[model samples]
Target chain A: MDQRLNAKDFEDALPCDAPDSGPLRWAPPEAPLAMQKQVLETRTSWADLALVGRLFLSRRKA
Target chain B: MHSHLSPDRPTRLCRLLALSFSLIAAITASLLMAEAAARDGFGALDGARAALIFLTTAWLAWGASLALIGAPGLQRRRAQPDLRMPQPRTVILIPICNEDPLTTFARIAAIDASVAEAGVTADIAVLSDTRDEAAARRERFAFARLLRETGGEGRIFYRRRTQNVGRKAGNIEDFFRRSGSAYDLAVILDADSLMSGEAIRTMIARMQEDPKLGLLQTLPRIIGARSLFGRALQFAAGFHGPVFSRGLARMQGATGPFWGHNAIVRVRAFAGSCGLPELSGKPPFGGHILSHDYVEAALLARGGWKVEVDPSIAGSYEEGPDNVLSFARRDRRWCQGNLQHSRLLLAPGLASWSRFVFLQNIAAYVVSTLWAAFLVASFVATVTAPPPNYFPEAHQLYPVFPNTSTREITMLVFGVVGLLIIPKLTILTGAIASNRVQGFGGVIRATSSVLAEIVLTTLLAPLMLLYHSRAVLQVLSGQDGGWPANQRGEGLLGLADGWRSGRWIVLVGATALTTVYWIAPDLLIWLLPVGLPMLAAPFLIAWTSRPLTHALFRVPEEIASPPVVATYHEVCARWEMTWKNSPAEPSAGMAVEHHVPA
Candidate 1:
């Protein structure tokens, strides 16, 4: 029963993203929010062993 | 012998025979002197007798050593293992200074294509020391474009130095720092170095089999020798030099020379021990060790790694210096670097094998200086001293003063002649026996080329001796032989500069010989084999780069052609394709570009 960490949980741990935080902002507001969220989700899925199995199967067939 | 001589040519043949005999007589005289000197005193001889005796003895010993090494019996024993196998992943490093990028890139591309066709996995890196940003950018762009077009983008990498701290050594060190950990082994190549893909595969297989072995240095056969000077050197290196190197290998046992390139070294061993030490003194003999190979070999040996020279490995190649001035410039640095080994000879904690090598390095300089002095002293003594009487004064303890016996003299003549000619005969025999004769223009051309090479070598020997002697003097006088990047193309002789640089030895030897000749015509005639060549240097230099001579002789074709590589390529190609298809990291593409076809 190993605990799994999601992207939202990781981002929330950062001090700059906290609700009370001020005077510290590195990210630009105009950046594509949907693309960024998709990228994070894709990265999170890669950490799963099932994804590795699928990738190997695809490579062998190719 | 008499029946073969024509009436007109009898005298010429006789002179040749006499010259042969005199060389032997000179050697015997020296040996007898050494024997006598050892019993009573060597110091008792007048300076002239001493010098003549020493020079003759040194030449005789060296010649005899060469003869022994080239003996058929020795040749049969010097066979290498037939360890040919499929190629392994190879990293080829071409270390360059501010050389022409176009020529360098073209050569690299040619090698790349050859390797690719052979199907060998190769990583090529052009390690450049050009500090100028513009020049660096130009090379980078050229390399990038070449790689892209050739489909070698991931296999070729070009990096320039921000700081050229240690020259060639520093450039290589930087590469090792970045990417050395990735490759199996690195083939350190000079800009002028070019080896066949098959030869590379053979070297790789040999390395793969012998994991304990650290390096395998191939004897580079000279190619592209367009100039007369270059051609002569090419001939000597291809024909006579191998026998001497075989002898050196025999004597060196485990501790052999690493001649920088045309060789392979284990990556880990090189990284661990090849970091050179900064000398505590000034330039010429000190500062950053100019000739790092010798010291690197020593360091490798000290670290319990084996460094050996395999002269039998074929197809390793390099270009010779185009002319006399270019050669002198190169020799000047070599002289200083070799002289610097004197300090290492005294260093402690080194293995006995390494110490012996260090001694040999130092002796390379010392012996040259000694021979130079001996040459001068011989002439001075011959002039001032009275001639030797045929009959000697009797001593109370001995019945007669020991003089050279007629029997000994005859034996000496045969021995000296055997020493000079037997090595060439052995090489000819080896060429035939090995069936390498078929590759060249068969037996006839090989035999004729060998004969021509001997005559040319004999003429050039004295000139080289004179040049080396001057280098020795320059090193001893504390004049720094400024390090120049090796000259690539042919050019006219800078006559005034050449004269200024070489005048000391030339003037000294010419004046001494002239004075000696005036006093003793017999001695002068006896010394003509050596004297005539030195006197003919200016003419030799002027004609050294003549195109007509090169074309007529077929000198380039005789020496420069790569050995047959069909079977070697087949084996390597099979291995490389198999490796590529296997699951591996995404190809970085840096490794194959150095060998891409131009």
Candidate 2:
């Protein structure tokens, strides 16, 4: 309920003026957004079903 | 300047008064119950039962007394006026075992984004002690994807230990030994932990304001609970937990609770004092301390460093186990950890309060076994004892009627119930009066949620008693609960799985019920409350685990989740796509050095 802790206040308080020199530095992905979305959808469904199925079957077996 | 207790005598007096009230209530209730039992012609066993109940209820009363004393504090939002001081660099350590990397990294991303938005000088380290091959692969991919999504390559670092020596405690020590010098503070977090940047900054600033403050823990609200059990817990935590927490803080004085995660600690203090030495024994009783948090807090307190849990600090969040079985599993692990404290009670150089706190934690689990024993004793008394005699023997010509304990017994029950329910009602009344019930969907919804939580927990208590009793027994029998990754998120628990987990409870419940019925039908009513629930354990576990049933016990956290919760969800949603598209095969190590980040 603190007034200073609202979402917009949180978003606008970015603190990244320091020079970036860390192991996380990497080249941007070349994959297009459309292709990425398509791959992501297929993968998401497959992964979701896989996890759900595994958990469900395992519990049932127990 | 940093005395743990107050210099003012009145404050100390208040503390003593609260402590005395708890003691008196427990003593008085126990005596009354014992008196009632004695009148029924049941003797020593009943007396022992009454004594154990006294110890248990006394502990509960102590907690209730603290909550009552601290209830007013909840209404007056403890303000932390922006101190506008230079913030210390913090290393947010997210320790992971074999958990879903997608979910873990999503939480990290959320925390990282919050920190970035707040412009706080904090770095996140995804420290994994995960030994599973598949989980490690997913972890690597997830880390790389997280870096890509947030462009936080250098800001977020990932490391997986090959030899998990001491489990989570060791994993953290590895980080402190390697890179602890770089950061002034370390904010430890669990895999499911998501804390706001503002909250982290506040913690760091508060630490800066007080040089002797070694650790500051936040009361994290349970978010993302999508099951009936989880929601009930979530609701209770949001509504009832804080008042009790405030009371505990008051009782704790300077030596407060350290729940391991969603907390910040001075790196120097933690490194100097909290290097946990394994107990001289084997599994369950020895090796690595499973409940390292309490000991760590005690160590800090012993070193004259203040450890505190500030309930007023918001934006800290974590997920609860979604099902009763999962809850029991986690409790089993905690049971081993807490029971291990029995050995530490006599641990040299611990402050008197620290020793007492250890006993308190131990009692939390031990009380379950005590309750089971009390029930058994009552059953025995009912079965073995002769029926009450309305007429006296030939000593008197007139029949002298026996005294009924109905009134005394009723009063004793009411007293115990009042101790449990008063604090909750106080919190509700305070919230409604102050118009702060809006966050909980107004008074009606809030009251309904509270009622639902009470009902849910009442049904679950007997099952928990069975679980805790078994856990305590397992630990006593030298069985160790190895560090297991908590099962988070919404998932269905099949009836077969529920039965597998709860069959013992069912067996115990059935035995208790049949024994009571065959022996004394009058006592059947009393046993039914506990017994029926135990018999219904499987169904409760399976039914409450379903996401659809969550609506029945909806909490404020779910109804109006904090920004951090929403942020976590959003980040996870975005990452879900990336995780799906991520190559199963490790991409030549993702261009990272295997060693710890410099």
Q: Which interface RMSD does candidate 1 score?
A: 26.3
lDDT of 1 by residue, B266-372 (tens): 87878777766667678776677777788777766766677777777766777678777788778778878888877676554455557666665665556655656
Tens-place lDDT digits, model 2, residues B78-186: 5574535466767889889877666678778878888888778777888888876656665766776676667775567888889998788888887887777777888
Clashing pairs in 2: A13-B117, A15-B119, A24-B153, A24-B154
Task: Find the candidate with the highest DockQ and give its number.
Answer: 2
Q: Which stretches of candidate 1 lie over 4 Å from their true place?
A: A1-62, B1-29, B34-67, B70-89, B131-138, B386-421, B429-440, B491-506, B517-522, B548-598
Supply candidate 1's per-residue lDDT for B537: 64
DockQ of each: 0.01, 0.02
lDDT against true structure, model 2 = 0.76
